[model samples]
Target chain A: MSRTANGRGGHGRTGGTARRGTGAPEAGETAAELGEFGVIDRLTGERFQPEQTLLGPGDDAAVVAAPDGRVVATVDTLVQGVHFRLDWSAPEQVGRKAVAANLADIGAMGAVPTALLLSLACPGDTSTEVLDGLAAGVWDAAADAGIGVVGGDTVSADTLVVSITALGDLEGRAAVTRSGARPGDVVAVCGQLGWSAAGMAVLRRGFRSPVAMVAAHRTPRPPWRAGPVAARAGATSMIDTSDGLLADLGHVAAASRVHVDLSSRLVPVADKLRDVASALGGDALGWALTGGEDHALVATFPSEDVVPADWVVCGEVRAGTGVTVDADRWGGSGDPGYLHWR
Target chain B: MSRTANGRGGHGRTGGTARRGTGAPEAGETAAELGEFGVIDRLTGERFQPEQTLLGPGDDAAVVAAPDGRVVATVDTLVQGVHFRLDWSAPEQVGRKAVAANLADIGAMGAVPTALLLSLACPGDTSTEVLDGLAAGVWDAAADAGIGVVGGDTVSADTLVVSITALGDLEGRAAVTRSGARPGDVVAVCGQLGWSAAGMAVLRRGFRSPVAMVAAHRTPRPPWRAGPVAARAGATSMIDTSDGLLADLGHVAAASRVHVDLSSRLVPVADKLRDVASALGGDALGWALTGGEDHALVATFPSEDVVPADWVVCGEVRAGTGVTVDADRWGGSGDPGYLHWR
Candidate 1:
């Protein structure tokens, strides 16, 4: 899952100082004052490493167990003012979002995460509180995935950029790539769809009371386990909804050389999302169909019976190309999905 | 190995437009004009994937063979103004430098590299020609290492950032970590030492001739095979010289809780380096001791007999703390080692 700017806030958002469980960093000591090693020590020291970590930090490189004889690897980068803002979200939240993006990509391949490597480049004057919060958030999210950060590099840059590489073990299973779907397969999805986009919309409108929506925007909890579950249930293809449901499904469609037609009524849109859409004079269904960054797992199963209980069947794959809703092109209000640098 | 300012030009250095083997991009099309997937296709399409790569690009994640049941991983980032100036070095050279840095770290662990993941973030106005040069350079370097570009993410940012993650296989050997040097071990190094520093000095003085020196500063060729050779020869600890000789050895000293005392006469300072230093009026020995980014492999062996023939013995691990030259602290003209943001 790649970080993309939602249509609402097209960059340039700031927020308050971040506070994390690890406590604020050394009374506002900036990264420059702490120096590189000091910052590294503060971030990596005392963190729990899982069994997969044969070697952790304080070395030239880290060794991780790839028990299945194969490793799944992916990388994603988040740049401040481009993918996130210090004012809109806490440093910890940004950290979680970074990890979530890469982990979700690993999950999309039907692999269980093993280790993560973080390379952070930020202005020297960045407060330790923000750095600590970012590290704390990364550690917390990594813990949730049962993985640990192995090795990383820290450097100085004019901008704050967080790049993460997530490694995963496939558990001896064939990877569920986007090209595996067939014309007869059934399309399904697991986890939240438009909550992040809705949250971003609320945040753009200057209303913080819909805290749940805003939090979802800040830290998306991708359905990490659903990927492997779908793979085990004989999924034909899978991808995460980083670029909205229709847009992500389009990738599967193009790669699988098949057409996807979703039943408009079957595509789940939450009641809470509808309420927010109405209050903001927005389209909840439109957001659910086209907004990105929710990181929901969408996959295609050979038949309805093979679709797992956790996945909601939303569409059918047919012989053709492109994606459609109710047998026609999606007449959504916004673009099907937004790509960076466009 | 991390990128550190060499203390000469500080940061502001610029050069000419990049031209690489793949040919310049179509009429200087900017990345924004091509969009994200288009850029991905251009950078990744038709690239070679070595046998270790089970799945290459155009996927949620790439699957790589980890024949040794474990994977060695490391990450490094190079920022445009911070690590390299596009005007001084071509995009291809910057790409090669980024890969070289991470691969050197993997080699320091006594592992054979298997694959690489690149996360590139640059301004929307960056020309596709530069992007193509970077990709070509990355592919060329990966080819030399017998690996492939497995997966990556491309995004738009205010500055150009190239972050790479390299993975390696240990081939059943124990990883040579930083904390394993013994008190009686002899320190040896393989590959160029002060050439990069001299090259940087030459560039800072606005003289680009002495082509070899400037090239060395642009692209370091780490002795990748020497790492495994040292491991087989019973080397106890290893590190790459990203922060010069004395500074990197200090890491080994602190990690192993041993003192490292170098014999000044035994250290190999190349004749060409002396020639460059003479012309530039710079101290070659000082540059060799304190200048960084050469990425040479330095290791500790039980004794001279077990040291590989290709390595030159320059120092000994002693029963004390801190690094010294001829049993005394180095009186180098500059900092013992430079750290980013210091």
Candidate 2:
């Protein structure tokens, strides 16, 4: 049963790769009720194939061709309680967040997403409705990014854990690494900064009025095309706003061996950030600076003038260490980013 | 930090892939002590780069080259206390089993392994020694299969979960699938059968002196080379013995629209099986036919004579439905193979 192969008989729970797709159509069936094979057949029955997917699911392994012969790959794991609460986000939203997080990482490398491998650690009692929602969410996200779900694995675990490995194509351009920033570089960002984080705070406070913030927290919409665009436009160093702007930029400053000075005033706040912060008596600017999971791309360019119109210049790289905001070292409270363990 | 790309700063706990290489020289540091980034640096500091790895870890996404313009991928997840118990196997053995299970699936596709992406979900209390052992085992297994670890993700979870995605190269050959077997084909197997299952039973019974079977249950070495070799030999159909000889063959027969009849006397049994069975008062033959996780490759050939010398013929494919033994349908008892969540 470990092989969990394709269209095999005799192995009751064997046969199929429906962790996301390669989506067979089955309705209202729990994974346990349908069995692994039946669920796989239902989940992999219909999948939107992208051009880069030389081979899709329903085999021992799916084949994907990279014309550049270089495939960019990274992975992320999300837990049930730590990453999201089932009460706060629907199954589709959870899956979308998972995909968004990984895709943003690919974007950080300035690579165009091509394929994905999704592993779902589900409990036996999980309803097929949840599975369908998750599969649909993954497919939709990949579709949005112009990629395909190639292969995956599914197993029963104590809690739901979504693990995804994303592959991307560099398109014959040099990848923007985190260690490439130098002095005199202008740090800029495209996409929302703290909407998701603010949304998270709003959700935690049980406020439903600002639906947009809550929606952003549940399903982040990353600027997918911005990756290759920034690369082509000559981004010296790049990263995704996964752990909050300052925390992420801290990584850039550390890796590039330079200091970054950010004007908090220049950091554009999310639409609902001020409202949510005011209602919760929280700092919207703090969320904008340190909130993560927005999947916004932050890059360093030699000159701010070269940055596209869509991106906003917020900081500058200098010959120093650490990250400073408004010409002073901002000693924020709490962990810079979310740490798994205490 | 979302990019979580190569060794970067400010993201206090962000950075890099650490499957087995980038062997960092840190001693006596637990995951709790080292945190995620420190562990990443120590783990991904030095990795053995295979020819296919155009860009190894220490970046947002790794780059693996597929010269054949196609890449084959599959994944598997091993859960602690479910797939294995920490007390029954060492950390290294668990990691090795994880790689072996995934590689065996890739081998079933008749492809050569090129790169791997490994994800680890463990508690904060896990020691660096355990991490080292797991990393070393993954590297050793990948090295044994002539591949490299390109990228992966690490996170904290309630329990230990190892998720591995394996990539392979077909090298200009047709992938031998289970649906190609003809009615007149012969069924053959290369490698051990009941050893691992019997080993599990022995371990559960606390018969420690019979070390080999216990070891087999802990670490299964699948015949990786046999996959491409079988593809070259023109096998009609193929599958790995991950779900027992009869159960796995039943899949092949079902997929190929044929009936497979096995001669129990013809199936190979390990040398120590009789004594182990006698001592444990268990049926060794039954174990030989139904035991799973041995990772032996079972395939259908055009004829018995055409089968490789190392493989033993045990059955024949016939124009019928279902699987039979000695000209009668074999209705074996209990689980066909291991299934999670009863």
Candidate 3:
């Protein structure tokens, strides 16, 4: 391993060649040249300590409050090639995606997010400004979710890897888990579906779309408040639309031992995607049903009660063990959903 | 990437011929064959929970208490090659080292650890038994530190990477920061020094020593209580010996704008290391002075009081900048303590 001092006072520049398609300026220096301490100082700028943060960067540990007494926690990791491609996504987008993924996990559990801790690993040639952009994205996402970036660790690696841990507060409410979906419960969704998948397709096919879909694919804006709202509305079960609608619903089915059926007509697929899919001889409905990364809220409610206006009725739970679509079992070749480790 | 699946079930196998000399059993299966859920189930087996844990694993998130209102959080990552070599340590030792590194960060803040969230990335061919051993080591270390492994994420990767986030409770005590050390404070240490570096030297040279030093390097047993004890006893500033004593103390100096002078005779150097250093044509005092990974507690106390029994008065704080030894600038060409992100 090569040893080089890095930090704020080091000889490293801030920005450099922005990978390939990221559109970032290529004038910054790599992390190795900046050194560790200098990079940390740069990352922990004035904005690190927001109003909600009791203590921010610079210390060994950061102090935040779980005023409700209960703290909710979740962790997720995004490997360079497996979870993202540096050539395809900007550093800011990668940072946002990393935070969004963990925040979605927290939202699925019916918690109000409070803080995030990040551990980032990158190659020695990685620019300090790219890292700063990543930090900017993280901060922006946390601010969007009303949380703070409390602390993080940085290291050198062959490939870029980002790991995030999100902490939340339940505020005396019980967590909504996937295991609580009862038979006869109504299934509902609170955000857009298939938009991210459609965006991903467009990106892969080297085509363009109404900027909205592409933006959705690059950085999902999860409805953070819907989590506590569902909990308050007595949601029987809950999950985020991370691994496609059907795949995530399957988790609730397997955990709760209840079958769920979804109507294709209820899902909101982009109109342009329908035309694009028809042109490509593919099914837009499949993308809406099996596409992941939308991060919409999928939940189960009692049949007798009406779901809030924000949530659309997708289907209902039945006495069974698997997920179905419009009374037919989902027999697609892809097994259930994305298994994180697999 | 060779995709051979380990068939040791969820716990992963430990024995296999392909096992590189890491002390792990050679004949073992990979983690992929066991699947993601299976591995999680195997690792968290019937562990008891405290009342503070409202909800544990198996959900999108876990709920724990932040009774004191504020939660202290820190994160650290240990990469396989950079932090530890499999040829020199066992999986259990790696697990312990990972936990210790993060816990030491929490200890530096004078907080009592509450919970840990881990994200692990490993090759698919790794045995389930290896994972089990690693979990066992994590549990053992957490138990020793009076903390809980509340939640974690697992993923497949080309190399083994463990990122841990430790949450701690201040317990109504004010956070002891590095900036708190005063010019007139007495510098003291509460645990072993140079042991881990000596063990590393032994491991690198292919030499053996008392099991204690080797174990010290493998699984450092940090003095967890010393943090809170020193805090309660009116310690003005503190930090763990993750880097060498002088280097780490230099941090306090930089933070507090005070110079620290050390007495070489007062610093603790293991006797066996002294002999080993002599044989290696090196100075044992230098190791004791600059060696890291001891996880020992070093703090500043008011010069008006006698140091506590558990601690030894090794130095004194003076009005100046940077750290010195024997009233002179102590400089050695060896490792300049631990560098973050290295």
Candidate 4:
């Protein structure tokens, strides 16, 4: 979800500015022109908060009642050039992406996201319209996830950086950790895989058509409620597919002390990206295997039969180490899973 | 707290490689060279994590038990050049300052600091040693406040940006909000005021020493415990002095619908900075009145007598609006209170 701002173009990305139901920012009014208070006022308008918020913005610190007496927290930071290119994205997409990623992390924890904290740092020269667009996208994403934007901070930087922290309610359920996977666990994934990466490639190669892929790349819709559903159905190990399916599954494998073996042809995600892959002369299977930022939930279950419709089995856990596709080890570094520094 | 990172020396401050604690990053061993996982691993070593954490790093989301059934949250961001000049301060000092400011906000809300989430973005070319220093400072600061570093995120940005989100436990006490202030309340503050501002001026002028002031500018040590004390003593409203004493108090006044009349002569913060101000030929009173980032907690108590020794009355709340210094309206804008986007 990090780096997904800029609702550029009229693509029907789930996080598009058009879907935000708001007026566009005036082209001439930059963030510096409006000043900090003005920008904060417009961005944090009344729409983003929910009734469950004990105390919303405009205070030293916000109070959120944690009825379960336990809180689950995760934070993600998206830098302008590194995470997303402003030219490739619209402000709304960036906001949606940030919120969605954090929510995805919470979902991976087997919890329901309840609140979000946004820490935005953009150059003074940024347009207020863009900021508003970003805020609108953030609000839309929060509503979609059944949560609220609670508290945050805004600062001036030479570049734009949005860091989102999401807090969730476990609803008295035991948190599903990465360490819980066992030898007999069945591997599964719910939500997208290679679409985002494929879309990025489409955008990079200057081909605009395959609109669905482009939109998914612009705004990923993480399966927000799947975390709670899987938790109730007995998920053992779980993680959001922010670092590609194989890479994140590798994390689960290492932490759970079990090996995961995936059947390349068995994953349904490759089918969804086949058209986009064809246009780019790319391997959708490879993209589905290692492409990151889909924010998809990758988990291991004691049994696959109980997994809901949102999730599908892709592999199984065995008493070995590392991840393999059809009993062959996954490729080495630079194999598309999306390296941040690179 | 937003703009108080660097202990700025007259030296060129583009993130010096000199100020790290120990272990020089190998030549050309940049963050990019180490790769995301390598850098994350080196930055999140075991020693920095505190034991109060139920689930530490490495999970999708970390779990923290809130025994009081409520959680208070706040976030703040500090940018390079704007917040701190790397040449003037050590990496550790930047980390400490970030954590300290957020803790101050929680304290102002009458809560005990519990966990911190660090969202860091620095250029990939940044040295590993610098990251370690920043992490060390964060750990040290968390330990000083009796809290733990629970989770965080790291990304590559053109500039260094550290955004911190802090969560707190209220311990069954009602949160002290700005709207609760009442007429006839005693207005008081705990901790230093002008020191940080004065220190900044000294650094900006390329004049070092009065070592105390320089240190204060580089790293502010907030009166963290005094916040809970004020709340326990029936304080009606409270805010951390991040926006300078007058500007922050102005926020309290506007929110509480009360006029705050301050006795300029009573604020003793001027005494400590008199020497630094004298050396710079600046006004110590002005700095005390409007200098920011000392992270002092200002609260409105039901009675002057109940206010703790750590705090002293500098004003009184009356049935009116706005703030007055010595029975006169405070100075207009262009004051020292860190205005953003101006």
Candidate 5:
């Protein structure tokens, strides 16, 4: 079961028309005109791979180094209309978001991301500018994670779909899973919460003010490294907050068979989010608790002393089931989180 | 470039309705009603993973053992109406085809496939029966390859897309890349050629009399093991005939900066294919030379004697350029294989 984040509210672009130029495909050149091989060459022709890439693209398959004798793997897909709109998010931003989702999963397992494989399905008439931007974004995010796109496939379809597979190495350490939390563990979080949801809210209302919020929605900068840090600090269990804090925490609780008790006051609600919420007549606490797609790292530690300094202790694991706020079930503005196909 | 096999004329099936009784979905159940988690559970819950899957599904990511410290990774995408039609090929057949595509790439690299990651995107209204068949097909192929699907992601999309990533092990041997063919290498093939194209031709003409040809189109039996055998026998270069024999060999010739000359008389053409060609007024030899999607292992060896007993020697590599048939460029019916987005 590869972890999938659902119900992302996509808005904006109708097609891959190149707007801002930075190594984008030349105007008027479509993927069909370039042909499959041409498009593939444009996507993967020039790239510097790490030492972990024993044999990169241009082969039947790429050879990646999995030095620890084990490889951590995950797959994530981003549909054009369902995940992001071209008008709202740049092709590069969409590319970054796609890679970020899988890298965050790798980090949640307390492993170092190694390589990425991309499978892109789009209409034949898709513009080269969009392809270039998407490629740039993918390579940029991969570079940020210290890896590269070793291999990929490109095919034609009715809609644009970007599916990415990420590989990671555990470095001889045990993988921290979601099923290991105990009754006496401490619940902590590192990285932004509710920012992406708030950003989405801002975008949904037809307002683009508060540039930071909209940017967060377009590109989530997950604290991926914090996952390994927590694991090294003896984290009992961990997960990435992709499906909102409460919803994701519920996954950990269900897997670990432990109850999570959250103190609303202890859960940090950023002043910026509060300001945006007040302006929009929204509930900041509800957003923090239930809004998803921030890609934050939430974890459980045996004790407060073992918790990393950067992680904010907001809850505790107890002898019960499900999650609670102020010792009671959460009755908030939103449901636990968005469910796909609902 | 990920070596995409283009131009498979798809036929049949409108949606995923349970036509078969073997582990099919309950009557009229849909993925939307089951929700995302339910769909995931059904897809991954009941599978038995191989020893290479150190940690199976349910976590943020899966851990697969890579005993050789290296993993051969490749990704391939199969789009509805492009690669397969549900009516023409069962959902199980589609799943098998998707996984088989990647496994062939792994084999072409002289590696043994170890694990698979699947990403499925379809409408919420997709039938549970279709999904079940798809999962069954995927697992069956994996079992045959001595591996399992360790991780995957499923999301909602207008068009159904099956994207698979296959990981393989080199077992401490040097990867036989495409750029290693020498001037005196002998070109040999170890699997059926043009069979899939012939099957597609039969289907296109509304004649399915030859069940064997249609079955070949539905589920190709790639000679994946022959890759490592050829490598052990000291193959100089190798590739899968996904994009037809001549086109694929052209890739080798370009990458290795050598010339490949195929002797027309030596190329194998089965009598059944000849009969079918006679009925359809199609050239069997032309199909054998340029038809794609057979997943045949075509490689170059140091000499004809060095080629394995199972392989059929058909050509030789020279110190010049491109691919030539009978000492001249091919003047065949089809373009040197099909081109995607053309």
Candidate 6:
């Protein structure tokens, strides 16, 4: 049964009366008083549906059709303090980031996201407004990716944690995996790099910056369409710039069995970050290479084909098994790439 | 990128190795010293995969094929102390419970589980042995369900939280939903009911029970094949008895728009729970009606057909929109099914 805000008489809102006849607590009452299952029923009371969903909440598992014969799925979790500080990001930002992180993964596979299932754990003291904002954020991100929130679960816990599973459709296209790159392919990028990392540095250092990097850290606006576009354009390999650009590129290199060389001169580092880098006494090149969470699209394409408008050629794949800088190993004097996980 | 304990040249017998291939820790290295991404890489390396997995960990998302065309998916989260008590259940049991919960959802969908994606959040102090045990539990459960651990994410958090996403394949059968039950259909149940609840009561009230009930609470053995069998038998609707029997049956009643009448005598309330019920001055019927987490399959079949050997006829569907006990309305005589979102 689909739910709508303006639905039938059963459990519909009574005019100006905060209570419904479902034996639940009044509107302002605490969730503990109403209990977990009761709140779940109210939250899911009336919701719209998309044709892809064969089943939605109230069943053991939801059935969604994968008509294209292949499904691309990814999961990510964002914990309160470790991933996002409540003081720095609103509940909406947290929700958006949680969805964005996983959506980026689906994009890496060159698939169009279809649906999202979110599970949230939060303290009882959390305001309902916060929950509504989080839901709005999830919906906004899903809308950006042309997907719908098919189902979710909410539970009370000591800290707030958001885990999202994103499912995608390949649209009959072969998935562009990281291992497809070969020597002589042109390496290009379609989105900003290191912006989120710079923003995180600013946040950690408690310094205000004139750059939009601060906003980038709060919500990453990944180029969603670039994935399918690259797949259609014969891109050889692809991955999202999640961990620092160099770290993620290293993954592509290892998987593809090819060395990738980046030309620093071709990278477009944010000008606003120059001042922040100076203020923090950090190298912009290091931030560009080692900073993570940018959600940028890094892809390899055949050298003969003209690069797309949104993309900038940054490097080329070479015959090796690791990443290099300007055709040299990263340890050379001028390179600032490669930060070990430790 | 498959890794095995004896195959990889990193780490000693103890699991506390750094990502940089450094020598094993001197007995007590903290996870903080090893770093976040490093621990993730190590844990991913330790995880094993089954054949159904086309691509396992190391990719943004592991790929698994659903040759059957349809996919059944479910997600569930376990919070420390609420869903499980760390003192009562070992980390392995926690892992098993998490997998069991999601796997049971797949079973309720009348599909065969193929793969699982696990997301774990834990405090930094958690030892590598504890994590390994947890992984072993996940692997064990996946093995039991004939599925593989295809992908997962791990992060640091203040409390332990596990979220599992299970994917299943339906072999060309129409998905049996809760809304499909018609009037005059017979209600039948497969597997044990109220066992987990009974065990929980024993643990909560400091009473003892048979090892089977305690094991049931720790790791539920869901009737995995019963769902697909019911589907093949042309059952109209089905659901897993996660929440109390009546509460879950009420879902079928409300969804199907039919009254469901259950004969209390048909419920399999374990004999071990009878003495504990008397000790707590509680009615076993209350536990049978309101107890949750049994993970049993309850479905409606055409009354003219014979029920399966694994299932017992419990009641029948009537032409109304409510649930009853022995022909009396639900919530009568202080016998209400568990409430939702409480």
Candidate by candidate, in order, the iRMS in Å equals 11.9, 3.2, 6.2, 10.5, 11.0, 6.8
Give fnat for candidate 5: 0.65
**In terms of TM-score, how similar is model 4 to the real structure?**
0.92
TM-score of each model, paired residue for residue: 0.93, 0.90, 0.89, 0.92, 0.93, 0.87
State which candidate, 3 or 4, has the greater DockQ: 4
Tell me the tens digit of each residue's lDDT in model 5 across B247-279: 889888887889999998999888888988899
What are the chain A TM-scores of the candidates, in order? 0.92, 0.92, 0.87, 0.90, 0.92, 0.85
RMSD to the hidden true structure, all candidates? 7.9, 4.0, 5.9, 7.1, 7.4, 6.1
Worst 10 residues of 3 chain B by lDDT: B1-10
lDDT of 6 by residue, B201-282 (tens): 6777775566677888888887878989988888888877777678778777877788999888876666766765676666
Off by over 4 Å in 6: A1-26, A29-34, A38-45, A204-211, A275-282, A304-306, A328-342, B1-38, B41-43, B46-48, B205-209, B272-282, B304-306, B329-342
For candidate 3, the C-alpha RMSD (Å) to the true structure equals 5.9
Candidate 3 residue B35 C-alpha distance from true site, Å = 2.9
- Please list the residue runs of candidate 2 whose C-alpha ends up more than 4 Å from where it truly belongs after superposition: A1-29, A332-335, B1-30, B303-306, B332-334
Q: Quote the chain B TM-score of every prediction.
A: 0.92, 0.91, 0.88, 0.90, 0.92, 0.86
lDDT of 4 by residue, B28-81 (tens): 468888776665555543434444467766788778878888888888888888
Report the C-alpha lDDT of model 3 over A1-342, residue by residue, as the tens digit. Answer: 111111111111112212222234334477777666655654544453445567666566777887887688888788877777767778888889888877877887788888888788777787866787787788778877777677777777776778888888887888887788898899998887777777777788886565677788888877767888888888988888777888778778887888898876776666776875776565677877887887888999996375766888878898988888878976643224455456
lDDT by residue (A224-325, candidate 2, tens digit) is 679888998899999888788898888888878899999988988765678778888878888888888888899999997789778999999999888999
lDDT of 5 by residue, A1-342 (tens): 000010000101112322233554543488899877766766666566777878777778888899999998888889988888998899999999988888788888899999998888879898988888898898889988889788788888899999888999998889988888899898999988888889889999999978888888888888988888888999988888778888788888887888999999999899999999999998899989987878888999999999988899999999878999988999978546555577
Clashing pairs in 1: A14-A87, A15-A87, B14-B87, B15-B87, B15-B88
Q: Candidate 4 lDDT, tens digit per residue, A1-342?
A: 000111011111122123323765543487788767666656654454565678766787778878788898888888888788778989899889888888888888899988887778888888876788788888889888777677777788899888888898899998887778899888999988878888888999987758788888888888868988999999997888787888788888887788999987777655558877776688888888887888889888998787778788989999988889888986633254555567
- By TM-score, highest first, what's the ranking? 1, 5, 4, 2, 3, 6
RMSD, candidate 1, Å = 7.9
Task: Please estimate how well model 4 matches the true structure, expressed as its whole-model Cα lDDT.
Answer: 0.77
Q: What fraction of the reference interface contacts is present in each model, in order?
A: 0.64, 0.58, 0.48, 0.66, 0.65, 0.39
Candidate 1, residue A130: how far the Cα is off, in Å: 0.9
Q: CA lDDT of each candidate? A: 0.81, 0.76, 0.73, 0.77, 0.81, 0.70
Model 6 lDDT per residue over A1-342, tens place: 001111111221112211122223346444454456544544433444466766655566767777766666678888887788878887778778888888777777788777777777777766555565576677667756666565556677888888888777788888787888899999998887877877877887886564488888888887867888888888998888777677678878887888899998886677776777788776777677767777788899997366677988889998987787787666522223222222
Best by DockQ: 2
